[model samples]
Structures are given as structure tokens and as C-alpha cells.
Target chain A: MSVSTVRPDVYAQVQHFYARQMQALDAGRFADYANTFTEDGTFQHSPGAQPAVGRAGIVAELERFHERFADDPVQRRHWFNHVALEPLPDGSLSSTVYALIVTVRPGGTPKIGPSCVVHDVLEITEEGVLTRSRLVTHDQEAA
Target chain B: MSVSTVRPDVYAQVQHFYARQMQALDAGRFADYANTFTEDGTFQHSPGAQPAVGRAGIVAELERFHERFADDPVQRRHWFNHVALEPLPDGSLSSTVYALIVTVRPGGTPKIGPSCVVHDVLEITEEGVLTRSRLVTHDQEAA
Candidate 1:
């Protein structure tokens, strides 16, 4: 395993990338959120789960998510913390972050949905940094 | 109103600094947490709240916090996101982060406390980055 420090600029780039990506998703901009990933990017909900491959597949999954919550008036916000980035030997970046999903309904208290850890492989391109793959694992499942 | 992009390394530095500082506090290492600030640093909970001045004063306030939660068996975690940093004319750094405080008791669901924004003036010291001043404002208060 190669362990190298990630440069500051790279860290900032990844941070900004997620900040923009999550904001787009939370705001219901499915296409914009999917664009943050590579055309062939994959999103796995958990280990052994069928992955959403490619931009269209990713957008389909997000649309399903929208429909699933269509009846709910609650707002959901994704907060990422403890973002640790590692420079891979292939010139990509391996990033791990704690993902907190907070949901709030009108005039109701905010609730944390579940504790999760997101692992991402990011590649830099002429367009900026984009996630090549992402896998999210619930804390309970990890235990 | 200079809006310069923060360098990647500087962004990484600030992220690691907060990660370490928040972990120390959540772990109940009050003194270690207070040491992340300068000797004469100030911590204001809100706009009109009296600030805790100096390391000793900070520790004293933390001790009060410890006592307040002594009877509770809940674990508290501080998650920070959307960290925006700016280089100041005086060579300091201005940092603003959305702070989420999550609390979970054994076998209970996790809940988010109040939403907050923390603003800090950071100075690069020989020992790395240290907070010179910190002010936290609740989201409701801002509205």
C-alpha cells in the first residue's frame, strides 16, 4: 500500500468538487450531479450491491431517489467530513469521507438518517476533478 | 472583498487542523482541544455571548460543558463542511465552516443538534495553524 500525502491544492479541489456535487444533488439537479462523475463512473450503495454504471445509469438511480421521496416534504442535506485523500500510484486520488445525511421537515427537528462512509476514486481531467467510482458503506454494515 | 481561491495545501492544512481539534474535544480532552487556539484566543458562542478569553478561560468553559453532560450517556460528534478560507491582509486566514453536532445514545437513533456556522481567524504559528478567534452563530439566529 502506498501512503503519500495529498497536496493542498488537490485537497481543495476535491473539497470544492464534493461541495458542488452534493449541493446539486440536494437541489434536485440530477443531471448536474451526474455530470460531476465520469461518463463511465460507478456508484455502489454498498458492498455486493449492483452498481450504477455510466452517467445515464447514475441519473436513473437519482431519478428513482426523487420518486421515492416525492411524497415527503422533508429536505435532505448531505454533509461530508473527515475527508482523507490519498494520491494513488496511477495518478488518481483515493478519497474517504464520513457522510452525514440530515433530513428536516417543515417545523420539525432535524434527524440523521444513517451513519455512512463514502469511498471515492477521483481522476483529474481537463474539465476538473471527477469521481471515477464511489462506494458508500453504512457504519452498521461495517460493524 | 478580495475573493482569492484558497491553495490546495492551505485547504488541506485547515481541514486537518479542524479534524484534530474537533476530535480532541469530542474525546473529552478539553485541555488538548483548547491548545489548538493561541494562548489569548477568544471563543464566542454567539453574537452577544461573552467570549471565553485565553486558554485557561476556554478550558474552564469546557469543564462546565463536561459537567453539564456528565449524566448523559450520549456520544457527540462535530462534523464540519463547506469550509471556506481566505488569506487576510495581515497574513492570517479567515475560515468559515458549517458545523453539525450529532448526538447518539447507545441503541438510539442519531439526532442533529442546532445548525451552526463557525467563523474563525487563524494565524500560522511555528507549531502550525492556531485559531486566534472563533465565533459560532446558530442558523436560526442568522435568520
Candidate 2:
């Protein structure tokens, strides 16, 4: 078995970046979330439909998502789990994050759901931020 | 912004581990998948029901999942995105991976689905294998 080359401090960075992502998402900070991606980033869903590519595209898509959710009076607590991050060569990182979402309606039962797999290839920005080259596979079964 | 402790070589190790994990999964080697977690590891879904803790429990849960699929006589290929491995102080790692699951029906069209998010905390075993401390989360919505 080969010795691990990964240093200990990367976890702190990733944890920090992810926490910000969650905070932005929960606070409906679409613009901020969009900025987490690289300049030429891409977000692809299913095989069909056009993918949201580049920083501008990500911003637009997040904005659209925020707008659509604006009408939903229910509050959702987005919980994530089963996450695995592997480092790639050339300064990029590929990671997988699984989510178990629970949507709560006021004075009603909360709806729980199965795994939503989010696979991404990320690059650490010069400013020490995590940006996406590609964010693939956002399970939308809950929607 | 703080400087990064995650160097390129470290990323390579993280990348290889995940590639091996997926390879084992696709080959129907469930035990290898289970072995990817630590002894006191926990796999949580929805924070309800008992977390699949320890190797035995994790194996049992995965067996159930594989059994259900095997009974259905389906052929599926769940593609995974790159792995992001964030190093922890103890030389362990926290990671996130994104996946796209496309299930092709028996002699039917392949149905594409949304991405799921998987969040995990893992530690490297004495043998150098990456093992999970916790595996949790789910899909956002319908595939």
C-alpha cells in the first residue's frame, strides 16, 4: 500500500468551503453560490436539456432556482451525507456529496427523501476558494 | 485566503482510492464497498432508523440493496464524478462525491435522472485503505 500524500489541512479548507455553500443555500444566496464555481464551470443535470455552463450560466440557474422556490412557503432543511472527496491531478479535485433532504411544511409532517448524489470536479481558486469545473448529477426526484 | 495544504500528489492518492471503490462496486463486489468504512463507521440516511454502524451492519445494508436490485433483473450503470478528498489532522479525510444514476430498464429505454449528494467522513486504515466514519444523505428529488 502506498503512503498517502494528502496533507491534513485540506479537510479544513473543504469543510470551510462546504459550510459556506450550505449557508448560502439556506440563506438563498444564489449569487454567492454561483461564485463558488470556476469561471468556465458547468452544471449538467440529466442527459437531456441544456447544461448550465460557465460562471454566468451558474448564476442564472441559481437565480432561477431561487425564484422558483420563492413561491414555496415551506422551509427546507437541506441535509447532506455520504460524502467522499478524492484529489485529482493538476490541482483539481473530484468529490461526491450525498444528500437526504427533509422538507418541512408549517404545522405539518416533514417529508423525507432518498439520496441525491452530487458529483463535482473542483479547482481551488487563487483566493483559496473552491470552484467547480463541472457540477454533475443533482438528483431532482424530490422536486 | 490561507494557503492550501492539499498538493497535487495528494489528490492523486485520493483519486485512485475512489476509482478503486467504484470499480469494485461495478464489479458486484459488495464486501469491498463495505470495507471502505472504518470499524465504528456509521451510514446515516435521513437521520432516522439506525445508522449502519460497523462492518457487519454496513455489509448487511448493502446486501439488502444489492439483493433488491438483483431480484429485479436490471442492468444499471451509476456514473460517478471525480472525488474530492479533504485531509484531516489525523491523516484522515472528509470528502464529497457527486453521482449520476441512469437505470436502463430490462430491454427498455435508459432513463436519466438528477444527481444525488453524498457526504462522508473517512479515515485511512492501517493498511492504507480509506474507510468511512459516516456515510449519509440522499437525493434532492425525482431522478
How well does each candidate superpose onto the true structure, as a TM-score? 0.61, 0.55
At residue A68, give the lDDT of candidate 2. 74
Query: How high is the lDDT of residue B41 in model 2?
Result: 73
Error of 1 at A33 (Å): 1.3
Could you give me the TM-score of model 2 versus the true structure?
0.55
Q: On residues A1-143, what C-alpha lDDT tens digit does candidate 1 reach at each position?
A: 11236666777777789999999988989889889989899999788789999999999988886897798897889988877676789999888777878889999998775766689999988789999999997654423
Model 1 lDDT, full chain set:
0.82
What tens digits encode model 2's per-residue C-alpha lDDT throughout B51-93? 7888788778778777867656444445456566677787767
| Docking quality (DockQ) for each candidate | 0.18, 0.08
**DockQ score, prediction 2:** 0.08
Best by TM-score: 1
lDDT of 1 at B44: 90
Candidate 1 chain B lDDT trough over 10 residues, lowest sum: B104-113
Clashing pairs in model 1?
A: A8-B8, A8-B9, A9-B8, A9-B9
lDDT of 1 by residue, B19-89 (tens): 66886676688888788888999999788889999999999988876797788776677888888998888
Superposed on all Cα atoms, model 2 deviates from the true structure by an RMSD in Å of 10.6
Stretches of candidate 1 off by over 4 Å are A1-4, A140-142, B1-12, B20-77, B81-108, B112-143
